[model samples]
Target: MDLNKKIRVFVVDDSMVFRNFLIKSIGQSPRFEVIGHAINAFDAERQIPQLKPDVVTLDIEMPGMTGPDFLRKFLPKYPVPVILVSSLNLRVFDALEVGAVDFVRKPDVKDEITSKQFVSTLLPKLLIASNSRVRMPRGTVSSAPATTMEARQLQTPTPRTMEHFAGENKIVAIGASTGGTEAILDVVRNFPANMPGVVITQHMPAGFTAMYAERLNKILKMEVREAKNGDKVRQGLMLIAPGGYQMRLVKRGTEYFVSCTIEEKVNGHAPSVDVLFNSVAQNARDQAIGVILTGMGSDGAAGLLRMRKNGAFTIGQDKETCVVYGMPMEAYKIGAVCQQAPLLTIPSIIYRQLGLLTK
Candidate 1:
């Protein structure tokens, strides 16, 4: 971003108090300029195109026209990044599917601590959003594995399809932030249910990870859930690191389990991808495949490089397919990634590298 030009932001919320709070909070930032505010989506639509703000902070529960509805009708005509500020709920994902760049959950109990916490997260997201790619109705997440295979491969793997799948003791570790929710789902949904157990760290606030895990479980063939302290890393399961915790890979007597604990935030994120990837680098070593997906910042770059140096294959999402092109770009710059591929092709790339897919 040009230093001379401050990031222009537009605020949209139903509650006057909340709207004023946003305006006041954002106004304090020298990097951000609150160009305008709207009490509803209808007003926002009218003002946004004319105002042409760089970013939009929206509340999903707006009266008359909801956030998702507005995104559906508005984004195509006037492309702009939108950050949803919503209470803990699944509807925010609906907004995300429609093209919202990111979301900040409303403080459960409005207080000094909560407000500061909210801003600390929101400001960085706003910075990320300012540089993010706003996909119109975002690409449809591929459910099929990226390989030439029959449906049986995903459900019940045959001898040929299951080649190298058993006794491999390999695992895939994925990390993302920003546009990660759908991206993570996109990659994992393609894996066979028998694929080696995978772990993921997506930067999210506390309380949302469980919901995200539950949502992923419903959409995926493999079992998905938020990681608990002693959750085993086994075949056919995808464990998402719970928010507000640092999850590490622990090897105990030929079995792998996760250790999740409340810890100091790393790289400005509680569930830092670096922390997880570093643990994988140390524990899983050469038996891991590290994937850094679409996200902002350099959280996973160092850890990914560590994984690569330790003989683990690492992949970064290519710039063309990334939302912010920050994390993967940083990783690629540092030679941490063995290869960079488009988002949709990454699953196949992993499988191919593991000799699980045909050329």
Candidate 2:
């Protein structure tokens, strides 16, 4: 790949500093060029078609028509790759579920140090966005709010095979984003309630997490609930990070308890996989297993790699089973993953790893 070919990009953001900083950072990369820049969705609406950029960096919260609203309209007409640059808010994940290609966490670029730091991370996500293909519009997708059967039905499943686990009080930490609902449902349905205690981070809103948990609880044998501070980790139970907060595990002696904290978002996601995985790596070490499921971007790669390095087993859903293979691909490329398997085979893999597989 030639870094000097100038991969074209369009920037849609309300912040002048961010727009300037992003363009400057991309320009430094021998690989990217900013062809167009817009202040908000309305401006983007007029500029995007004319520029026809290969990649678009969008800010979800903009004045005069938000990014999501713009996406609701412009995406069907001109299907181009979009990478959302969002604040430290869970709402970023909501944009992803609506079909944004990837995301980058935006830091306040008031100083040169922060500006330089932002560029270092932003360029990579943009390059990845440039290389990837956006989902083609089949027709008018639903405008209904992110819940209801209509919303759930629109989710597409990523194909995967499973591996058997040895079965223990295996702590399984799973992460997902764009198309995680169905994947989590599939895995939980296959798992027996007596299966290991599981913790999950699905990019979702606060209200949505409760509903999702209730829905999953009705179908899967294991008990599912949104994580609250000081909750215990026990077999046959699953804890999901509530929207807008980061959930981690704190061990009081030998028992584990859920700890929730309000922190600046990392990787544009609250309840970020990075925070959960890092905490698990430090406290659980080899005793726990980390799994990164379907999602866009490289949010979990670093943390999962830390888990593997600390001797904990790590799993990444393979490309075939990922709606956007970005997260797993980044983890796999850096040797952070112990195994890469499809979704269906994941349960059995868990069983085998936990020594539950019997002849």
Residue 254 shift from truth in candidate 1, angstroms: 1.4
Per-residue lDDT for 212 in model 1?
A: 94
The total number of steric clashes, by the backbone 3 Å criterion, in model 1 comes to 0
**Which candidate number would show the highest TM-score if scored against the true structure?**
1
> Candidate 1: deviation at residue 125, Å?
1.5
> What's the TM-score of every candidate structure?
0.91, 0.59
lDDT of 1: 0.88
RMSD of each: 4.7, 8.3
lDDT of 2 by residue, 1-359 (tens): 56667889998889888788777777777778789899989999998899889889999898878777788678878878888887765555456545577666677777777667667767866776776656433356656565553344344232232243344445889888765765676566756656777999987655667767776787777799998999999887999999879999778888888898888899988879888999888888888888888777788889999999988898888886565677888989999899888766676566667765552
- lDDT by residue (5-62, candidate 1, tens digit) is 8999999998988888999998999999999999999999899988999999999987
| Cand. 1 TM to true fold | 0.91
Q: Model 1: how far is 46 from its true place, Å?
A: 1.6
Best by the lDDT measure: 1
